[model samples]
Target chain A: MENIFRIIVCIKQVPGTTEIKINPETNTLVREGIETVINPFDTYAIEEGVRIKERMQQSGSEAEVTAITMGPAQSESILREAISLGADKAILLSDRAFAGADTWATALTLKNAVKKLEGWRLIILGKQTLDGDTGQVGPELAHMLNIPFIGYASSIEHISGQKITVKRLAEDRYETFEVRLPAAISVGKDINVPRVPSLRGKLKAKNETIPVLNIADLSMDEKDAGLSGSYTQVIKIFTPKHVYEVKMIEGSPDEQAEELFTKLKQLNIV
Target chain B: MEIKVDKTTCTGCSLCKNFCMYDAIEITGGKAIINDNCIFCGACIDACKFKSIEITGIHEKNFDFSAYSGVMIFIEQHEGTVAEVSYELLSEGRKLADALGSKLYGIMPGYELKEKISGIFNYGIDRLYIADNEIFKHNIDDIYSKILVQAINKYRPDIFLGGATSFGRTLLPKVAAIIKTGLTADCTALSIDPEKKILLQTRPTFGGNVLATIITRNARPQMATVRPHVMAKEPVQNAENRQTDNYLKYSDRIEFLEFDPLNFKTKYKLLSREKELGQSINLSDYDVIVSGGRGIGGPDNFSLIKELADSLGGVVGASRAAVDSNWISYPHQVGQTGKTVNPKVYIACGISGAIQHLAGMQTSDIIIAINRDPDAPIFKIANYGIVGDLFEIIPRLIKKIKNGKGIT
Candidate 1:
């Protein structure tokens, strides 16, 4: 019997448009005008957290869901969006010191932020982000916190008191794990279908104010909080040159397969 | 500190056995053996008659990055079958090693793989490191990362490569974190600088809208994972005997090292694992793949794509949209987040070819796109573009294939 089950859902705002252009000289994304939204994967995480909170409430247990994001101040919109989808509170870890951070530094910042909360039963995260597909943040954060981590969680089977059972998706198999409280999990998109915000919820979200946290607020120093703490550095970015060329087989469907089959035979791929 | 014995150079000298105070050295058969109790105190090295023992210190002050050599590939296996990406990586890794004038090595961890990887030497690997332990049968990220980190630290390969499969995606990041090195995910191309001997890793970013070439810059034993089918698997040809089958016996060029995993630890435990609920289709094996998208309308329409796939003797693939819509199974989805397929011929029906989708199948030999919208992004990459209703076009393609006029 727990008085309150506190869960933290981490979210990130990534570029929404696919028409991203690179600055040829610097080899960096031109993020000036592109629209940004919550990372697509994080939406599933947010929904899962909210769903767990609802399940706790239905069972007559006091539960609170908090959504956290580490980005610029503009990322508050996604936190507010999380609120609209049933999050009880939202916190934004925003500061110039956190810019240019790699997954390690980002995890450090998130770990410090989580420590500031004092008590939390679980932390939920998306499998990975679109901008950086490293999939290292959740595990790295767990490493920092010295807690158990389960990646690729497909479903939450049950949660009782301080223990949670989850189904994780592996290659060609599905594994189930039972982890104690204070553990972190990164959920896959198959976990649950995120629900759309209702009109009433949207109205409430419009007026919500997200609290902002800076390096000073969490007592984290600059050297251990951002790019300075990161061990690996990206030296260059360029377009991958095509290793081989492809030949087109033109004409109707009948002619297309005919040409493809002939070419396959010629290449000895058949 | 670490203690090692070079099997090739040892000459069955038992003189060093008398110097070990802990009785860690034993004369087994003819060669001198170092047991687990050896404290690496270096007394035996001073007394070694043949001078076969090597001592390496782990302190940062004595560590030399220059001592690390060779390019290593992690051969991932599933249900006793080696993944195709392992061979593909070997093919690509050989070129990188040759450019740097380094030997190429492979590390495979599983329960039993002696027979499965017998043909690995044909790929030009100089040595094969194996850990055939029951703990490796299941995909446990923490345990696998621990073993790999130990192997990497011991072998000290300059560059390590793995396939960007589900296991690698989770495992490599943890390894990189523990070893404190750089790891690039889902790389499409790899090359050596030749001048500086750096691994140039290239991969897609920004939702597959842009490609980025990243370099480790400072880390030793640079690691990278490339998607399956991104590189062609070309075995080294043997002029002495050209076998009709792909597997050629080149055992002389390869050496084996059995990795000992007695000192590894992990916190998480796998309570149970069950087979996937639905049918599992290995999309990588098919030569021709027919995939549908949201344009197919509903779950019932997937049968149409199946009919076309059956007529072509191939498998049915679906877009993330179709899979999300519950029209098809998750295993059938083909996209950046799904499966990267390099089929001989790929037919995209009603799929708008999102950048995510293109990232998976764009490497196919020939892409034939059929969509009602002529300006669909898929048309840009399709060798043959069809602007018509898929319901109308797919049926005609299936009928023609069934009549043995277009396919056979």
Candidate 2:
């Protein structure tokens, strides 16, 4: 029998941070009806995971991939899209109890869900979710799982049998680590070229029934599912105080050049 | 208050250690490390003329809750080894603990972290509240928040602290939510009020503009994430009175760790320098910059700017263009995409600065812009403007600078 690898990739849907506009009057994110998309970094993670599974199948090895997310019912679209991209399964950890969860609670719930899944060969993650840009989940998940994690991975090499070695990105140099089976690795945009899902794959994903698990279903303590279990809370979410008032850069070269230099020099920039 | 010594920029600047009346700094590996007992009086930081010393860990304090009590530091670890930031938090914790007339505790979750427990004895922790398991190793927010909530509910500490690393950032917010407590991220300051016995949580708001001080009057365990390199990590001076009251609460903590074998394959790896672990920047004080941008067109063209910069005894810079185009190293990018510089003279050969681009380097003393675009933002800020193609002006500028005829 061929050695099989199972990969779980974590993705989050967030209000496009770049597109996030604050209500000028209230100074809060304009959430009355906002456009949301899968976090940019996570797309890299998903694409990389799909790429790994394809490579495994190409090499005549067993590889199964799962795309998992924890969000509301509306968040199901991203998973369906992931399924179309060749994820073996799509799992959602969603419930009213998970609402208003902090990073800690989200991590724990995912960890518990991972435990429920039991056996897996590789856990792929994005370096950060764009919404918060905290870049904490992967390392935190690794910490909670008590496994060696290679962070900000740029390349994957030497994958065979029960062992995998990845090129971990570090300050000034890259270090290679050979981790045993069963490790969580967070990848960045530098990881790989993600493949676009084929039409057939997208069609199949449309019919797939993604599974959803709640705290009650997982036998999780209610206190641990939401705000009760979190260590940090956003006391308030307000718009930034100093808005970049979109100063247009349009003027004559000589005068504008002089004006720019004077302002920066006064601010003591250059 | 914290004073960060960018070890690389520290040119044996003992002014910090010498100026520190509390004797908080000790130079190691050719860098200054703040030892314990350093208070945030801004004395040594102000004395460091090189400005290499940055105050990060310190935040404002809110002392409104006279009924608050206890100081707690979240013990963050990687692969069973505790991170140094947690210890720094502990050092800060002791002061908060004293102000509350209570004890300092290290809150951690894991299995078999006992070997590391001995180190906290010298840090003045009154207790080690630990919940460990095979599943607890990965920092899953749900599991950890739940466990921490259990621990906090059981013990009811007043102040909670975590390092501003990835793990703490993820988990702290969860714990704060569960407990309905207010939290400040990347806190640069933390203190306690003597009169009210409450914790003060201060963090920068509006992209490091104003300092926002928050207080949790009704919530237990007021929380904050302390930036690294602010508070001094005190060397154990005396710990005769220190005690480790271990609370073994494994009853409710879940068995939640699961491991997945990872695939390690990629076309390229992030250069180690980008991660900055076990390493530091050594170019914080370079007098001149010779930066390039996507305007150079490719990595090969970087040689032009490199040669020009080399001739000027300066370094190279880039617009976010160069970094995004992958034409140069991310470290070399000059815009908001890379390091913010205030060098004596910044030369923008082909760069057209965006507003985000200018925000980072608007402080350069003399900006010389050489762009074909007369409308380029760089020209607007340039002290000396050259409205010519960089491809044309650069070679001439290089020759002129080499022949000592460029600047006037």
Indicate which candidate wins on lDDT. Answer: 1
> What tens-digit string does per-residue lDDT give for candidate 2 at B1-408?
234677666787576664443345688877888753333335455556676876552223344444445776778775477787888888888877777678787677776675666566678777777666655655444556666776677667778888876456656755665565656566767777567555666654322212345455435667778866556788456664323333233212212223221321222222222334432232224556766765667888889988876765667777777777777665576643245566777777777766445645655656667677777766655666667556765675455445443343
Q: What's the C-alpha lDDT at position B174 in model 1?
A: 77
RMSD versus native structure for model 1: 16.7
lDDT of 1 by residue, A187-221 (tens): 87778889999786787788877889999998987
Using all chains and alpha carbons, the TM-scores for the candidates as numbered come to 0.80, 0.57
List of chain A TM-scores, every candidate: 0.91, 0.88
Which regions in candidate 2 have their CA more than 4 angstroms from the true location?
A1-3, A21-33, A238-270, B1-326, B329-408
Model 2, span A1-270: residue lDDT tens: 345688888888765333323344543332233356776667788888888888888888878889888877767888887877678789988875665455566777888888887457788888765444455566556556766566767788777656777875443345666676677788765676567888888987888888899887778887666555554433322222543332332345444444544443454433
**Interface RMSDs of all predictions?**
15.5, 14.5
Q: Looking at candidate 1, what is the lDDT of residue A24?
A: 35
lDDT of 1 at A125: 95
Best by DockQ: 1
Local accuracy of candidate 1 as per-residue lDDT tens digits, B1-408: 356777777876655565443356788878788865453435466556576987543222223569778999999887568888999999998998899999999988877665777667678887778777887887677778877887899989999999988778767877877887767888888888768778888776655555666676446788888888879898888624423222235455434455556665566666888876558766887998999998889999999999888867789999999998889987798986677788988989899987688877877887878787876778766776667777866776566556654445
By TM-score, the best candidate is: 1
